[model samples]
Target: RGFFTSNRDGGQGYDDIYKFLETKRLLCEQELYGEITDLETSALLPDAKVSLFDSRFNLVSVTNSDEKGNYSFNVECGKTYNVRAEKIEYTTKEQKVTVDDKRGKTHLPIALEKSTCKVAIGDDLGKCFGIKMIYFDLDKYDIRREAAFDLEKILDVLSQNPTMKLDIRSHTDSRQTFKYNEILSEKRAKSTINWLIKNGVDPSRLTGRGYGETQLVNQCADGVKCSEEEHQLNRRSEFIITGL
Candidate 1:
């Protein structure tokens, strides 16, 4: 549908809005909007940080939910975006949305589950986000970027509790000799402790050691053939609050 002005050379010499039907391209401004709420109660959540990321996980834009739990964004049509909503002590929720070519606004409501990180003395920050293992490349003990993010949860807890003491234990699968595994475990454990000390935690409150391959969460130890995932169950870092 399209329109043309008649005031230029017609009998009705006045500006007027006209309506017509035709096949033509028209520009459209696309928008995305929705509400953030609690998953358990369906209650509206306010002040939640809402972020949009592209397919590569690169951040595109960020916004916050208002007091009414409403958030919106100007978006492009025919593109997929990952919308994530997060708040402190709440489990972050992410959903992938593909905005179709159809015009107007798209509604994407998300609900966040409550986090299990209780900040108690026996809590394992590593397991708080449902990610139990902090993986290390074989023979590498340095903290990776993904590992750093996981460690931040522990750092946050320790920072809030000055008297908390952590026992950092690093373990490795039984792919190598016992002595070698023990040494590697110790190195990895110490590396974990060093990360905490380097960040802000006190040296006196942290103690670490490697358990070698002594503790296997599954039957993937020694020479038993197992999938890579089963082997990964044995390679993990355990951060426990031993004292508070």
Candidate 2:
């Protein structure tokens, strides 16, 4: 067996080691090879990250797709692995693989779909796709199921780009006192950050803020008569990418 180190700058400025071994053929061992491609057009995605995890969720190995979007891994007989492919602005693709008790190489192809949320740097709070103004119940700071579902997309973007940082901001309508709204919106923002942290996002990459009816989308301000729909628009949450 021999170890080869390459200065493959997979965007992280780090070295990666590749192992090579020469051995006799065994009936119970095999290797897995595959490529990552776009699910819609079937075009290859370069620099996509491929990760192999064991049954207990321990990370076994990680590699970046080459220019051709190709990746590979070696395995033993009957061992199970969860293979996940991730890329920025794309929905993660996952598959379960188990090597059969036969010799030879196995092929496992992965396809990732473009994410509905096209999150980009310098994008305004609600400008991105799949990101809408999150509304909350009256005076409530807890996260709703619908809000949680939408937040997952933002989480995916943050997870794939580890160096990215965001500020989770919350707002409220003029129905409540200014001070009260401010405090409530702050809690709401904290709640959003907490949910993301609980779902495996790093806390260092996130911050919470409450604008408290300060940045109204329209003229629905205090002493102004507005429809319920207009008021709902003011009570919202947003995610802003603060750093790269």
Candidate 3:
């Protein structure tokens, strides 16, 4: 017989013990349980996606690690399976297991490595490295101190990847004539490229161009009434990965 404590609708304040008759039981199917962690820090990685694949590399099942970084899966004995764990900003990790009828359960552990680059090649962004849309003071082409600090991130990424090339584009708000803004944006683009060259980056690895106010992010285009913050969104610099 089995027994448990419960508080039913008509029961008293104190919990009462309920009993049940024992019934014939069957053994459960074999299962796999595992944990995922960081390779360097050994910290548990929660919410990581875990996928199970058969010996033929065909996906069998998928699940995510719990908040405690634990995951489980049921399996057929004598079948070989591969498990892959993945999370953003981290390299994916895989492990293989072969289940046996003799074992009722299997334990697997995975350690994922951290990726070097947060933004990959061909990533276009309005902000990065705690800096929002690299912008210059009014009528200025030279790089600002804050912008220089933000550009350092690009330098680091380029230094890490010697073969990578970057394309720089500069834009301006639509406060001035089209030709005026185009010329100012072109100067700003040249200034950015020169700064990179002065910082020891190969000039051959970069190409700078200007689109002026032609590609406004919002309705702050010519004669549009918008706040300074809204206009500021259109006045910015953009970096695009041109080549590997």
Every model's TM-score: 0.64, 0.54, 0.51
Candidate 3 lDDT score at position 171: 94
Top TM-score hit: 1
Which lDDT tens digits does candidate 1 get at residues 1-244?
Answer: 7676666555465876677985676665568899999999999999998988776666789999999999999888878888878777676667899887877889999998887656566777556555346777677788876576556556655665678898988999899899999999999999988998999888999998999999988898787999887887777789877887
Candidates' C-alpha lDDT:
0.80, 0.80, 0.80
lDDT of 1 at 241: 71
Which 10 consecutive positions of candidate 3 have the poorest summed lDDT?
Answer: 124-133
Name the runs in model 1 displaced over 4 angstroms. 1-34, 50-63, 70-84, 92-108, 115-120, 127-131, 155-164, 196-205
Off by over 4 Å in 3: 1-113, 116-121, 125-132
